[model samples]
Target chain A: MSWADTILQGVLLGGLYALFAAGLSLVFGIMRLVNLAHGDLIVLAAYLILVLVSGLGLHPFLAVLIAMPLMFGIGWLLQAYVLNRTLGPDILPPLLVTFGLSVVLQNGLLQAYSADSRRIPSGSLETASVALGPFNVGVMPMLTFASAVAVILILNRVLYGTELGRAFRATSDDAVTAGLMGIRPNRTFAVATGIAMAIVAIAAVFLGTRANFDPTIGPARLIYAFEAVIMGGLGSLWGTLAGGVVLGVAQTIGGAVNPEWQILAGHIAFVLVLLVRPRGFFPRAVD
Target chain B: MHGRTIPWRVETRTKASTVFAVLAAMIIVVGVVAPAYLPRATLQDLFFILTMLVLAQSWNLLAGYAGLVSVGQQAFVGLGAYAMFAGVVLLKLDPLVAILLGGAAAALLAIPAGFFAFRLQGAYFAIGTWVVAEIVRLLIAQWKTLGGGTGTSLPGAATRAMFGTDLVQRLMGVRPAQAVDIICYWLALLLAVATIFTVYRLLRSRHGLALASVRDNQEAARAVGIDARRLKAMVYLTSAALTGLVGALIYVQKARISPDAAFSVIDWTAYVIFIVVIGGIGTIEGPIVGVLIFFALQKLLADFGSLYLLALGLIGIVIMLFAPQGLWGLFASRTGIQLLPVRRLLRGGSLDT
Candidate 1:
């Protein structure tokens, strides 16, 4: 039963990782731009939620709801104004700009909010647990896992079943052709980034409730998110979830054997996955 | 293919080279004499600048020349530092000797690291290198002999017995710490000079031209008989070796070692990247100028804390967007002058006459 519980916990923890990777995957899929600042943006969203919770007296979930559009605007403006120019030919500009953005974001956050670690106060949900047949699951974790699934389902639906989704795919396939077809690639990229940021907000809520966060924690989270994205194969949404599960399970099992090995185990899993399948488990046909 | 070709004389050196030599000699003389009149803090600051110069030059070689932008250089820095610590503590070697051993170890690690990183392309390669560094950091944290995650200082015996301390003390007539600073300063000067000279020479060589062609177009370079992979691997290994040496020297001067400090992205990789990018990456003179500006900025804005770092990032982004070639590029283009010129000019003297 304990072993089953561990595996269950691992899977649930993977939901959080999937949340982190989803935004990164979305941006990368549409534009082929890997945002080095993705993790820092996650941290930034979490801080925004914190601000709402403390300053405005809102519940964490409600605060995330309010922060969603704001983050979207930030993301949209960032892409339209800053990142779009960096695209085409040389990969260094986008990478370097994003790298600079990461540094700026991290230090900016540090200046605004001191180095103290913070966590979202989760009223009764913090301790509340549901008794299953073999294991007890925390309510917050369950909600987080459910939210992750819903986010993926909704993203897939939007991606596959809508006009905007068509634009995204068209732009991603060939920006020139998409532009010829009257689809604005730059605008599409901005919208895609806006959507990614909205998802990032959702992930931030779960991330804030799950653990303590500080400005510096973003890069580590980014590493895990990147591992998930890469291991699941680039551009495949569901693969990211699976990659998250792989990482989570590896980490928990490593922790079970020895506590210090937890983080190490996740990294080892990422490396092993890369070694066996360099393109990842579900590489996009286009790439 | 040519209808009629005449012999030409190619001149590699210019008046600029002579001017550069004179300036370098003067700087060396100033550096050698400054410690006598300058304070300890200034020497320490110069040491920091010199070490950063070495790292920046190494990174420029990888990113600027070979088109491999690694975000995980701190991995080598940390590895080199730990190797030095291990040598000094375990093998009972002098600190200076251990620094060399540390560099060798880092070079060795670069083989596998390069193998893994080369499999990925573009941005994936960057992230892959970072992951490798993180893994190395995590593994290093578990080693109890190196004081685990908390880190350890160089033993008293090691510091006391460090090579050249007695000579520095005898010459400078200073305290032990100050004497150590003088020795480290001189070593850093030598390392910086060697890094610049080696990079310049490598860039002027045939292999360097091959590397440039490879970077411009790998498929085309391969068609022209260049082994892109092998050349990239060589550059990566060489950069790692130099970075490791700088890292070991850095830790030795600090007299302490910790995984976090050793493997710090901000301190080692990010700062170096900022320096290289802003200074004029790919040019031999860029890092030298960049390091000076960076040192100056640090001296000016050190009190602003996080804001200083924020400004650096903002400025770097602005530079990348506006002047992709960097400050040195701007200056060079505007003046049409190069301090360390690598180009060979062919003059048809007899044919012209």
Candidate 2:
């Protein structure tokens, strides 16, 4: 039963990782731009939601609705104005630029919120759980997991199903050719980044509710999100989900044995996976 | 082609000479009066700043030149610390000697890790290096000799006493701590100069040409007989070696080592990235200027706590959005001062200005 509980918990934890990696994977897939600011964006989203919930007196879910589109617009503007200019023959510009952005975002959040760890106060849902086959699961984790699955499904459908997805693929393949097709490559990139940030909002919602989070925690999230993205394979959302599961399971089992091994276990899994499959378990895109 | 190409230059010796002279002047003045004007600890703090500058320059070589943007060079820094720690804790060697060996060890370890990570490109390459760091962190943490998760301490004064007998101890007593610190500061200064000169020379060499070709367009480079992957690997290894050396300097002055302080991804990558980005990725003087500005910002906002990181993120985002070329790039465009010159179109192979 304890085994079952740990496994279930691991699966749910995977959900949060997937949430974190989804935006990262999407950004890479569509534009090959790895926003180093990804985790910070997640934290920023959490703060945005917190502001909404406390100030506007809305539930976390409603706050997410408000945050997602807003983040999308900010992302769109960021990509079109800032990020788009950095994309070129040299990938260094984006990296260095993003690193600078990371410094800026970390400071901005600190100035506004201070260093205090804040929670969304989910109330009843905090303790709410369901017993399934003699195993109990927290509602928050369950929701997070469900949300991750939903996000993946939606992302998959959008990438493979819609006209916009086609545009996305076309842009990813060759921006020059995509531009020749009158697709407005910059616009496509803007939309893609906007969508990526919207997904980040959902991840932020889960992250803020799951545990006490401060602005400083973003880098750690960035690490986990990066691991999950690479573990599954770059540009593969499903792989990100699986990658998160592998990390979550390893960490949980490691913690089950010795608490200190929890973080170590996840890192070990990442390294071992790299050793075996350097391209990742399922690589969908190549740089 | 969109337009007629403008030829780039190969040599930047004149500009480099000027910068070197200026640095010499600063060292001369600082060395003379720093003790009299400033407090003892401030000198130590300056030592730390120099250490950060060295790391920045090393990273610029790896990513700015080699085009391997690794987010996880901290592995080498941590390994260097551990090497020094092992020397003190296990082999009972001099901490000073251990410092050099720590860097050597870091370089040695980087050889294999670089080999593996260089197999990938772009973002995958970044992730690969990060994975190597993570593995090292986990593995080292398990090795009980080097303090487990909780970490270990450097052997205290008895260990420092062990360096020499009573006579040497008395020598050490007269040996002003400030003087030794100044000497360490000079060491850092020399190391930075060596690194700058080495990187500048490499960028001027034939191999540098090939590296630039690879970074611009790998396929084109491959078509033209350039081995992009191998060149990248060499740069990555060199970067690790430099980073490791910086780690040793940190240990010698710090006189202690720990995984958390050494392996910290934040400190290792953050300042490096900030300097390189703010200065200019491919520019020579950019990192030097960037590091000074960066240190100033950190000192100014030291009390801001995590907000500092948030500020860095915002700076990165803003820079990516607005000045993708970085501050040094802008400065170079305006003033044309090439402190660290790169390969330009050599006229009859005599590119020196």
Candidate 3:
């Protein structure tokens, strides 16, 4: 393929990565809680979508729509019951708790699904493609990119244009002061996690349709998502998108040179970014 | 006034510690002589415990004491192992000497890693360290000489000719393999004891106070003229070196090395984190108690496979939620006893006098 085509493919692949990162970025921005299980949760959502598609005989898109609310509920309960308890001055609790959660989720998934790789069978759309000025792109990739844009746009709106957004910002800035203002930082946190999980559902649909996923693939996806978040800077959704694109481009270019270097190249790019701009490209004013 | 005795004195070694020191010496004596009476299987198990203790102590020093909270310690472990392998397979050095090389290599890697990761704070720092580990794993996999993705094994000649194995064999009247196991076990025991002793000493020193202050509040620690960054970096480098030694020794005992196994985040980082967290982070005795419990759980849950991991995860979460200071922390608080107390107590003082 031509260089432009390769670059374009990388940009499209980045959409999937950005989708993975959006939820993590949201949670970290709101609570400063780095959920190590964020990737496992995405995988869990993918499994939920898979079951809906196969067992219920629903379309993959419809399966995602159903899974989103269910995932939101799980996220809500998890935050309220499990994660909120770990928040405090000590960083060890939240980190260890989430790491433990990651292990549990992975092992639990292994017991439930075996080690087999599963992909959501999105027939016809998987093979369909659209030509854009001497380049052919899969219809699914285009849709994925479009959906990623839509998710970010909607999240931006919810974060900036709504009363809920104000509460989120208030709680993030000063949880104690926000608590004094009757904002109920814990409840706001639960809501934010729920929304993040809902986004995970959307990302899951794309993830399941695009490739074969097994129980252990979660951590790799997490690293990709994390790299994007770091590159983009914390608390900036648009920067996350750009970070994903940069990572995707690096991987594709590396793959073009040597297939083995693909993942390495992306990681190298992340480290280089860290070396240059430690806070990332678009750090927030406060933290 | 000149003859009056000093009214107060500061002391770090409590009565409990004084008694515990005798108990520890007895335990070390038993550990050293265990091979003669114990079976090879039991020896291997002891080896596992000792190495894990070393790793847990190193991690505790980093996260519990220095406030680093790294999740990428496997990087150092893997580097140490690979460096040892290179030393043995390519450089034709003794495995014992290579172990030291492993520690040096890991410490060297820490310089750049710490420089990069220190830029991030708290949770971000944790992920940054993990990223560095991932990078290291991928890069090591490219080292085709050391078996690349598939990994390599130590030659029989290297294993058979390892220093002190023959002496162990002659002294114990065991086969070469068993002697090697004994050697590794002794080395592991030595390292574990050294790690614990060194940590205890460090925690008792003025630098330990600096580390505690840094963990409590970095800005406050900095404002007090404690070079928090330098202190943290020193701790990071020290932890990396110790972890590297443990890793090299572990791989030596296993007699095989692979990128995947060596760099596994779960085995090297996650489990160590769990051990430290569940035991009582920031305490010397916590890891000792935690490692014992962890070993017992593994034996009990051996048949459950993935369920074993799931249970461990659940237990870790539960401990973090209800008892953040860990089981040892709980015990220490309720009993008001410290077997290895590092806190300075002002005793034998009365204002009325």
- TM-scores, all models, native as reference: 0.96, 0.88, 0.98
lDDT of 2 by residue, B39-81 (tens): 6578777777778877888888887777778888799988988
All DockQ scores: 0.80, 0.50, 0.88
- Note the residue pairs that clash in candidate 3: none
Q: Rank the candidates by TM-score, best first.
A: 3, 1, 2
Candidate 2 lDDT by residue in tens digits, A123-200: 788889998778887889989999999999999999999999999999999889999998999999999999989999
Task: After superposing candidate 1 on the true structure, give the runs of residues whose Cα lies further than 4 Å from its correct spot.
Answer: B1-6, B9-12, B344-353
Q: What is the lDDT of residue B119 in candidate 3?
A: 85
Tens-digit lDDT track of model 1 for B57-160: 99999999998989999999999999999999999999899989989989999998888888887887888899999999999999999899999999876776
| Deviation (Å) of A19 in candidate 2 | 1.7
lDDT (Cα, tens digit) per residue for candidate 3, span B228-250: 88998999999999999999999
Backbone clash count, each prediction separately: 0, 32, 0
Docking class of 3: high
By DockQ, rank the candidates, best first. Answer: 3, 1, 2
Error of 2 at B252 (Å): 2.5
